[model samples]
Target: MSATIHRIGGREPSLEPMLSLVAPDLNLVNAVILDRMNSDIPLIPELAGHLIAGGGKRMRPMLTLASARLLEYSGTRHHKLAAAVEFIHTATLLHDDVVDSSDLRRGRRTANIIWGNPASVLVGDFLFSRSFELMVEDGSLKVLKILSGASATIAEGEVNQLTAVRRIDLSEERYLDIIDAKTATLFAAACKIAAVVAERGEREESALDAYGRNLGIAFQLVDDAIDYISTAEAMGKDAGDDFREGKMTLPVILAYARGSEGDRAFWKEAVAGRRVADEDFAEAVRLVQASRAVEDTLARARHYGQRAIDALGGFAPGGAKDAMVEAVEFAVARAY
Candidate 1:
């Protein structure tokens, strides 16, 4: 399918459609999240709530709800599972902040920054345990395997990314592998579980998985592109955080590959923790723009976003499908 077909009169795409479609069910998921995150230790709730209650798109859990709706799932079994997905995602964010030594998330103080790394890591573990508890309560071996495996893969992805950090030679393929494991696995699991709950066949489950996995990659690519171009106000996080942290994202990889000899030396220093200043970031942005790295990174995102939309072609055309498609559009359009 042509990419332009998804565009509506050149208007910006928004997540509102999917959010609206899933809002009613999302409330119940939110209730489960609130209830499950409670504990006897006051600090647990306080720290966890600091990040949980903080503004978030809740994209992972919303995928669960929307996928269930797509399958015409009439049962409420998905509510707790969806909450479990959110818990897993939240735990990862907390740990990620600690790992990255990040201070801001969603335009507010990070959990690690406020509560300190020890507290943040412990709370993250608590949330992970809570997610497993919710999974066991559901009593589906298949569901248990999918989510638990995703959790492991996400951990593995984090370690993989950690090792690749500041390595100027990091290849695009390796970066894709890291992101597929770290970010896309949960998205795939979240959508696939809806098929399991609905008692649908493997075909439907796989289709939803493909939709989410592609969308997740697309989403992360947009985020990587935005890190260089967007502001803290727009991104809800520091704009140069990735650059400062020496993350080997696609834009960097492309720019480094396509740059001149001196451009490459600048990237080497930038990635090696040598060049980091407002002016350095300004130069980095200029290099990426000149090389069309950001533009082509977005092109790659649109490519995956289109695959995500095509993944839903087997499902009957309806509001659920439309919302899901527009969600893909929104994912690819964010950097524009």
Candidate 2:
């Protein structure tokens, strides 16, 4: 890999080079995405579009398309699979905003804020159903099973997060497990299905799945760390939103565990009890930085980032492989 492979976007790098590599297939995926999102109930598309149109890089679907190309796939089923992957992602975002009561997304008003939670939740369900409809149309029982299982796992992850909210003692192992389900499973499935459509054997499938899994873990760790270090505009929401929401991300978990006694008390008072004092968020940021929690969290991300790179060792050296390797850094280096 070239030294340029580690380049960041001066901030958040665009994945356009990677996305561009599979632009033709991506166009087809987009077409399928729009076509599947359509519904007889006019409000369905309208509500779903509210969030879908506000996409932040469309990374999940891009993973599917790029994974297919990396393995030299040329079939149309990956398009349908990519669309299914996108719908699953979109549904989660819609439902997450409702669960989080978040006011912002992708630097825009959240869908739940505009359409209301009931409408957002229902539309999320509709999108999920639409995802499966596309799945069934593809006539791949294996794909159906993988995607359906992923949907269930996403729900379980969300439920776990729900239970953890407002609790300050969440362990690192538990936190990793939660994020693995909530974020990484779909990523693994997205890439794994690429090899499936290509009729590649278990080795290729496992390799791609490992790549996507590690990348997803690295991606979420960066997102968690950046919530403390980035601007609302940069993060598409307020910095420290996770703290405000009482999310025990790795940064918080580290700060709490490794912190001084005063630090532990401050964290418990601020996050554990759901305190909303005017200065509470500032104090939380201060503690997170003082502990170097974000930095340590990112160190953890870099580990997974390397693992993601290693998982691609079986692929032939080329533009697609190079882009995939760079993308692992894109998952973490931007936070610097």
Candidate 3:
């Protein structure tokens, strides 16, 4: 399908439909989250809540809810599972902020910055434990296997990314692999578990997995592009953060390959942590734009977004399917 389909009638795609569809379930999920994050150690909930209550779309859990809705599921089993997914995601964010030494997230001080890295890491571990508890409570060995395996894969991906940091030679293929493990795995699991709860066959499970995995990839790609093109206010974090941190995201990868010799040299220096001034970031943006790196990065996102939409082809048409499709459109349209 054409990327232009996301922009039909010159209207912007919004998450409103999906959010509206899942709001009731999401409220229950939030209740589970609140009840689980509590501990006698006040610091546990305090730190966890800092990030959890902070601005976030709760996209992963909402996918689980929406996928259940698409399957016409009536039971409440997915509620705890959706909350589990959010806990896992939130745990990752806490750990990620510490790893990146990020001070700002969602336009506020990151957990690590406020409570320190040790506290943040420990609280992340606490949330992970809570997620596993929810999974075990649901009494599904299959669900346990999927979520636990995803947690391990996310750690592996983090290590891979850590090793690849500051290496301008990082291949596009390797980068995609890293993101698939780190970000897409959970998305796939979240959706796939909905099928499991609905007791659907393998074909339906695989389809939801494909839809979610592709959407996750598209979501991360848009985020990669936004780092260079958007403002801190707009992005909820400082723009050019990836450049300053020397993270080898897709835009930098493409720009370096397509840039002139001088441009490549500049990128090397920037990625090596020598050129981090605002002027250097401006030049990096110029190079990326000149080489159409950001543009093409967004194009790649649209490709995966289309794949996500196509994966839903077998599902019956309804508000659920339309919301899911528009969710993909919203994911790919953010960069525009």
Candidate 4:
């Protein structure tokens, strides 16, 4: 599923404590990204800054730092690795907006919408190239292997989603398979790379990898939930963007499966058939809610959150590790 929803806004200061372990480093990483965005090429720098300042939660890189700290990694490579993750993520956002023909992202005009698709796509490529440069600076073939593998998986996931979009016969199992490839694989790689850097045991590395994978799945589940449940203003983007784009997310899959005959027919004609009426959007939301899919998806997320915490139990938990646990918990319980 797409995860461009939610921001650092809406919540109060209390949530700050959940990410305190690596917030300072995260801020530094942001500065590094901004500084690197500077280019002699005139409008390139400005457009890059506009995309960078669009206000992201920086969740991917934060996970990298948190995972490193949890295992007592004390090297500068962590920062570079974190920034690499962010670069890949930002590249994906640029490409996703173009593929979806999106106009709004984080409640602002998309780079494609304002600067045009050519610029957005080219800048995104620039970010990808810069990320590869950072990876080379890390000087670890293992790190390169993990990240390159993730990049490939992310691309495959995008292709899988394109093949499945608007197909009502899409099963819940297939939807999950797509997300596991597209979303969770990179997250798993991020944490696993930290484990490799920390020289953790094979068993611990696998456990941490599992933790990241499960956490990523939980994160995406909540993302899908918020898209169906949140308002456009609060979510920092248009609500039902997925529905309008003919993407078959979890909520719609469950609702369409359980909908009454008329509701089902309406979805087939409007949602699947690409003739979405005004009532179709509202009714899809209602049917999904009525199916209790949101509750079911939330339960799945909580299950994954619990599993992630369990994975961390193999290590000697400390303040930083405890903070990582709290971050995962907060990710699930976050009211975005």
lDDT of 4 by residue, 1-336 (tens): 222212235442233554688887888888778766667786767777776788777778888888888888887678888888988988888888899998788888888888888998998888888888889988989889999889889999999999998888888898898888888988888888888888777886798789889888888888888777888887777888888778888877887887889878876765565666656678777878899877777777777777777788788858766666666767787643
Question: Candidate 1 lDDT (Cα, whole model)?
Answer: 0.93
The number of residue pairs in model 4 that clash at the backbone is 1
Candidate 2 lDDT by residue in tens digits, 1-336: 112234543445557679879889889988888888888899988887777788567788888888888988877899988888999999999999999989999899998999899999999998899899989998988889988999999999999999988788788999999999999999999999988889999999899999999899989999999888888999998666788888999988988988899888888877765565647877777888888898888888888888888899989988788778777877777797
Give me the displacement of residue 328 in model 1, in angstroms: 0.5
Off by over 4 Å in 1: 1-5, 8-10
Q: Whole-model Cα lDDT per candidate?
A: 0.93, 0.86, 0.94, 0.80
Which digits, one per residue and each the tens of the lDDT, describe model 1 over residues 196-285? Answer: 999999999999999999999999999999998999999989889999999999999999999999999999999999999999999999
Point out where model 2 deviates above 4 Å: 1-14
Q: Which regions of candidate 4 fall more than 4 Å away from where they truly are?
A: 1-15
- Cα lDDT of candidate 4 equals 0.80
- Quote the positional error of residue 306 for candidate 3 in Å: 0.2
- C-alpha-based local distance difference test score of model 2: 0.86
| TM-score for predicted model 1 compared with the true structure | 0.98
lDDT of 3 at 41: 100
